[model samples]
Structure formats: C-alpha cells, structure tokens
Target: MNKWKIILDYFLKFLTALILIFLTLIIIFKFTIFNKNYIKNNLKENNYYEKVYDSIKENMENYIISSGFSENILDNIYTNKDVEIAINNYIDIIFSNKKDKIDLSKIENKINSNIDEYIKDQEIKILDKDSITSLVDDLLKIYTNEIELYNMFDNYINLFSKLQTILNIALICLLIITIILIIVLIKLKIQNLGIIPFTSSLMLLYIRFLIYNNIDYKNILIITDNFSNCLVQIVTKIVDLILICGIILGVMGLIAIILDSRKKNKKKE
Candidate 1:
C-alpha cells in the first residue's frame, strides 16, 4: 500500500508538471501573439511609421520623375504622423476583424494639392488628368500594401478570438487543478511541488533555445527592409520575454523548495 501511494504521488507530480508546461505556453501566447497592443508598442518602438514614410517617398519619387515634375512636388506630400495614423488604423482593422478600408482621403488630398501647385508653378499644361489620378492611386497602393502585409491573417481574427477565449478557460481550469494537487501533495508530506514549476521552466528555456537557434530571425526579409526591421525587433523581444518568464519561474521554484525544506526542518526539530 505504501509503495502504491508513493507511485500515485509521483504520477500526480508528473501530471502537474505537464499542466504547468502547457500553462507557460498559454501565458506566452496570450501576452505576445493574441495581444494587439504588443504589436503596436513594438512598431512604435522601432519607428515603423518613419520607415514606412521613407519607403512611400521613395516609391512616389519614380512617379514624380516620370511625370516630368520637380522632386520638390513630393515635398510635404505626407508626414510621419500621417503614416503612423494609417498604420495604426490598418492594425485596428485586422484586430477588430472589420472590413473597413483605410481612409486615404487625407493623403489623396495632399498629393493632389501638391501636384496642382507644381503644375501651376511650372506652367505645364500637357499632363493628362487620368495620369494624375493613376499616379495618386499607385502611391496610395504603396501605403496600403506596406501596412497590410499581415492582412492575410484578417480572416483568422475571429478564429483567433475564439481560441483566445478557450485558452483563458483552460488556464483557469488548470490553475484550479494545480491548487488541488498542491493541497493533496502537502497533506501527503510531499515537498516536491516545486518540481512542477522547475520542470516547466526548463521546458520553456528549451523551447526558447530551439526557436533562437533554428530561426534566422536577424536576417528575415519581408516586404521591405523597414518592415523587416520592425518584424525582427518584435520577434527578438518575444524571445527575450520567454527567457525572462523562464528565469522567473525557475526562481519561484527554487524559493518554493527552500521554504518546503525549512518547514520540514522545523517539524523535525
């Protein structure tokens, strides 16, 4: 009977450790992937808007030159603030699962106004109205494509939202089960509850190591260098966050073991 009880205790600890591992992954996904603000904050940190503006300017320059306009026509066509607003709106559309298109009225007006001023200043009358419209449309496309790289995921936003809800429910259920297991272990005088967290922490660290080593995130090339820079920064930060969580759990596990040891020593005395 004593042997069977020991076996049961070990089984319970093993089950608890398994749950802890899943719980750790769920927490990481909740904070990093499912969290919209994580992306927003990373983009802001990496100056993503400024990079986007530079790309837009470069792309539009080709149109200006082909249309026989001075490069000055591109001046003040748009600002970094405008790009920031447009990108944020694009993100909101994806996260909110809205079908609304990004409002380019402001940008369109600015480009048109600039072009009219340039044509008047140069007194050039040969440019076709359709050509001007085509130029404006093409420039706006650049902004849309750059900001909407992840628009493909828009279809899954609803599925992701449902998955997030399920994860929250699962996490709560796991926490309740863990608490019950802790109580049972304590009553059995099993002081190895720390093993669950310790094992989980190690698993997290191993997963982080695998991702860091396997993925060449530093050299990731996406739609453009600017976009890639922001993507790399976000990925690197997520990896660092995983490492931080692993260290925290490891420390907590050590503290738990130490406290349990002290309790056993007091009982012995």
Candidate 2:
C-alpha cells in the first residue's frame, strides 16, 4: 500500500473500533436509562416494599421524637399499625401507577381523613387541627421529598426526550459508517472485522471494572436509602446486559480469528 493509503487504512480501523464501542453504549443507555417503560417495569418487579417501608418508618420515628407532642400521645400514635399501613399504601400507589403530576393536596387530604378516623377510634379529645397539622406535616415531609425527587426524574426524562431525535440520527449514521468501514477494510484485504467486537468487549470490561471498583453504594444508601436501592437495581441490570454482550462479542471475535486462520491454511494447502 502507498503511504497515504496505509495511513487512511489505520485511521479507518481506529474509527471503526471507536464507533463500535460508542454504538454499544448508546444502545444500552437508550434502552435502560432513557426508557420509561423499562424503569417502571423494573421497579414494579422489585416491589420496593422494604426500602420504602424502612425509610418511612425511620424518618417518622425521628420526627415523632423531635416533635412537641406529649410522650403518651406520641407513644399511642406511633404504636398504631395504621401509620405503617398508610405509608405502604402511599408507596404502592406512587410506584404502581404512571402519573404525570403528583398532587400533594390529594395526598394530604387522604392522610388527614385517615388521621381523623384514628383519632375517633382512640377517642383523643385534645388533638385539634393545629396538633393534627403538626403531626401530618412531619409525616408528609418524606412524601414531599419523594415527590420532589420524582419531579427531578420527570424533568430528566423530558430532557432525554428533547435529545432523542438527535441521538437516533447519530446512532443510525454511526452504524452505517461503521459498516462501511468494515467493508472497506475487507476490500483492502485487511482482516480487521474481529477488531470491532474485540474493542467492544474491551470497552464493556472497562465499564464493568469501574462499576465494581469506583461506586460507593454505602454512602449512597446512607444519604438516601430508598433512592439508593432503586439506583442499585438499575445499575445491576445495566451491568448484567453489558456482561452478556461482552461475552458474546468476545466469542464471536475468537471464532472469526479461528476461521481466518483455517482459511489461510486451506489456501496454503
């Protein structure tokens, strides 16, 4: 090959490898991170009962300890099973349905109604609207925070929507360019097709190593237990898919090398 052709060949090979890795990543993130249906289905499958239940229980206990309610009243209120039941129902509703907007007013009203029933059952005479408001406000703090987080995620998804068209176009163009590069390599009598899958596998292995070594799940859990659990679930699914793809590509690369070797031997014979 002439100097210019040789340089062009090397550059195309490098570009092909880079595009292979990028294409794999784009596909993975597109399906897992940006796909709303996938996220919703995964959370539904996990149920999130333990994470949501424990966080709610702990935060409410802390709130009750710091509040101005009398010890006897607080003790009676905390001991009631309805608090746990209400929290579970709240979480269930939020996760089980795909709603555009979360109306805290509706949630507050339902909680107030539940509190009224609880007071009627306990025959507590001293608990007026002010006291009830204090208790409900304290309890709703966690729910409100959760709603805010949901809104943040909703905004994130919206941003993804704006970028989706651009991403799709780039993905398609990259795929076509990658295929053309591979075909050109073949026409130039360069056995470089295996490099695409080999580079893909290497990229996935690097990502897997980073995930295993760099993440601090403990700190995440400490900061926000429920959100951390959800994050872990999503990361786990992504890692699993990466591992599967890596293994498949690695195997294909090996098979291609073996076949290439066999073909060369047959020509010599």
Candidate 3:
C-alpha cells in the first residue's frame, strides 16, 4: 500500500507539472503566432518601410493642406524627426514576429551594411546648417534608443537558438524520466499508471506542428528594426515552448528512473 501511495504521488506530480507546461505553450501560441497574424492581416502584406512611408506621406499631405512645403522640398524629404520615428518603427515591427532567426551579429551586419551607405548619401544631400543641426538632435535620440531597438532582435536570437535548445533538452530528459517512472510503477504493479503521458504526448505532437508550420519568412519582411523585433518575438516564443515542454517530460523521466532505482535496491534487501 505504501508503494502504491508513492506511485500515486508521482502520478499527481507528473500531471500537475504537465498542466503547467501545457499552459505556457498556449501562451506561446497566443502571444507569438496569433498576435502576429492579427498584425499582418490588419496591416496587409505591405513592407513596414512601406507602411512607414505611407504614414509619413499621409502626415505630410495633411500638413500640406494645413500649411505648405518649401519650394525645393523633395518627394520623401522626411525631416530628422520623421526619419527617426520611421526608423524606430521599422525596428519595432521587425522584432515583433518570430521567423528565420539568425545570430544578432550576422543580422546586424547584413542590415547595417545595406543601410549605412544609403544614409551617408542622404547626409550629403542636406543643403543647410539648419537641416544638419536638426538632424543631429533627432539622430541623438534615435541612436540612444538604437540599442533597445537592436536588443529586440538580439534577445530573440538567443531565445530561439539557445534558450529554446536548453528547454528542449530539458523536455526530452523529462519525458524519458516519465517513461522510466511509469514502467517502474507498472512492474511494481503500483496501482494505475495514470493519464499524464497521454496528455503529454498530445502536447509534444502539437509543438512539433508549430515548429513545422511557422517558418514562412518570405511573407514577412525584416526591412527595419521594428520588423526584426516582431519576427524574433514570435519565433522564439514558439520554439521556447517546445523546449519547455520537452524539459518537463525529461524531468518526469528522471523521477521515474530514481524511483525505479530505489525500488530495485529494496528488492535486493
């Protein structure tokens, strides 16, 4: 009876931990994927730079109606403030989704290398001291926030590649442990084997589904910092959940192994 109690207690722990892990997986789907779909559908498939361009155009149009542009004003001649705000949004939206994750160094190099020369050309085109001075003020603000902007992508890369990997190892170990525990309970004939593994198997299957279906980065563009931000968040969350669940299962496996070992030594006595 005491042995049966031990197995029942183990079954209870496995069920509770599995439930907690499952809930976190739901959070991953809701926050990372569902929200991404929501934003994409509402915004349409336009590039975020395109979106920012449209926003600035609309703002300029309203300004023109209320006021006016200078005679030499060029089309797309955004002020420093406009440029700063647009660039910031570009970074934000990109980082929000999780897809095609790469290391931060590589991503930053690709984006910065592509953009710097273009910005340099833009800098040379400014015709006056007022433009330069105003640009400096706006840029200072933009650069200060630049780290936060880059950090969104950085966090996602680590989360998806490293953190999720660790979690996956954990889940695998847990599942293995759970299996051993179950076999022990059964071999010992310690009452019911319980419903934990049945439910856990379902979760593992679903996680594999998300990982397979969510890799379409072509639909999403990482044209700016904002776009990078969105991509990292969504992708990392999904992968991380897979890892967390894997870890939980692995823990259960370890528990089973330990219990089995204890039971074996008792038999030897």
Top candidate on TM-score is 1
Q: State the lDDT of candidate 2 residue by residue for 121-228, as single tens digits.
A: 777776367877877876667655543443444435445555666677878998898878777888887754666677678777887778878975434553455566
lDDT score of model 1?
A: 0.80
Q: What TM-score does prediction 3 earn?
A: 0.35
TM-scores for all candidates? 0.85, 0.68, 0.35
| Candidate 3 per-residue C-alpha lDDT over 1-269 given as tens digits, one digit per residue, 9 for 90 to 100 | 58877767676656644754555565455454544354454333334445445544454344334222221222434444444454545434444444432223433343334334544755645346575345334433333334234354554644444544555566566566656656665666653232354346456757666666877633455645445655665565567667666666656755665676677788899
Question: Once superposed on the true structure, which residue ranges of model 2 sit more than 4 Å away at CA?
Answer: 57-100, 115-138, 147-166, 186-189, 215-219
lDDT, candidate 1, 1-269, per-residue tens: 48988898789878887777777777777787667898888888887888888877887787667767778767876788878888888778766667788887877888789888988888889547898788778877876776676465567767866897898899899889888887887788775677777777887899899999999998999767877887787788778887887888889988888887888899999
lDDT of each: 0.80, 0.64, 0.50
Give me the displacement of residue 198 in model 1, in angstroms: 1.6
Q: What is the lDDT of residue 225 in candidate 2?
A: 55
Order of candidate numbers by lDDT, starting with the best: 1, 2, 3
Number of clashes found in candidate 2: 0
TM-score (C-alpha) between model 1 and the true structure: 0.85
**1 or 3, greater by TM-score:** 1
> Poorest 10 consecutive residues of model 2 by lDDT?
71-80
Task: Give the better candidate number (2 or 3) by TM-score.
Answer: 2
Candidate 3 Cα errors over 4 Å, as ranges = 2-53, 56-130, 133-162, 194-269
